[model samples]
Target: MPQNIYLEDYTLVQPHSNFVIAGGRVFIKKWTSLSFNCTIVTGNHKPTVGLNQRIIERLHINDIEKDVVIGEDCWVGANVTILSGTMLGRGSVVGACSLLNKSSPPYAVLVGTPAKIVGVKFSLEQILKHESNLYPEHERMSRDELEVLFEKYYKGLKSMGTDYLSPEEKMKSMQYANMQYKI
Candidate 1:
């Protein structure tokens, strides 16, 4: 029942779900939502061992200082587990039932058990610029202002692109493609 969960620039719905988040800054950029049943645990994983002694001394679990930053315009699927020291970049999508053990780069889509980068959301320059704008210290702008900026840079890309299917749709398409696998 820990409250005061630090959520910045991130949207979280289905609040009744149980989860623990500690000692890490959670930056939820614009349009990013953390769905129900998601657990973000931020604590030290380093186990301390005493030298020259067979017994283990006090385990020094450092104050897991790294912030869990979820970039802007991203969707975090349900039942997602984000471990300590994880950084998810902007415009990224994390599929459900995924375990994030490592920091993810900007504009990268991650999925599966070990959470591999399945897709790239944007170029390095774009990501860097977006990060600079999204930094907390910078002057905060309205959502409309951000949208206008995005449109200016990404309108052409959006128009030229086809509609991106949801994870469920993609799964169904895959199943359909493999006719050998019966429903």
Candidate 2:
């Protein structure tokens, strides 16, 4: 972890998820989840060209500021390297072992080196609506409560022939349903 690294309203689970970010920015939006072994580095690679020329000046620049912005309700898989200025949009999924070098569009599933959009997670409207409710904190629910909540929401989704829910909406709904059952 580095100074001024912002992980706003997100959840990071797993032991010892270390990062080396020098003068870099990391923004994890609301309800997003970052799994184990995720690293973001701001240092540029060693310059291979001549040191005197202005064209090679960028090569010697060691302290390049790289910012990583992960949007709302995103699921970042384990061992992911989010490079400088990489923006993953709302409701997107980054697959495991991927290197994100560019900005991803909202709701897109991205994977691979120089990650490409593999699929869409959900419609923008659905993401916005659903994420308004669910969040990672719902994992705090007791086993029995979680079971009941899952059964209720997942069953409803199955009936509707849908397979996904935004992280925040899903968690909040579960927590709400659990509370209802308790009373």
lDDT to native, each model: 0.59, 0.63
The alpha-carbon lDDT assigned to residue 18 of candidate 1 equals 41
Candidate 2 residue lDDT tens string, 1-183: 447677664355455455666667678876678888887765555454445445444444544677788887688889888887888876678889899888875566778987877565643344433444453445232445434533432333311114466998888878756322322
By TM-score, the best candidate is 2
lDDT of 1 by residue, 82-171 (tens): 876787865677889898878764455778988987655554444445455445434434455545544544433422123467999878
- For model 1, which pairs clash? 9-28, 10-28
On the 0 to 100 scale, the lDDT of residue 43 in model 1 is 59
TM-score of each: 0.54, 0.63
| Weakest ten-residue segment in model 2 by summed lDDT | 152-161
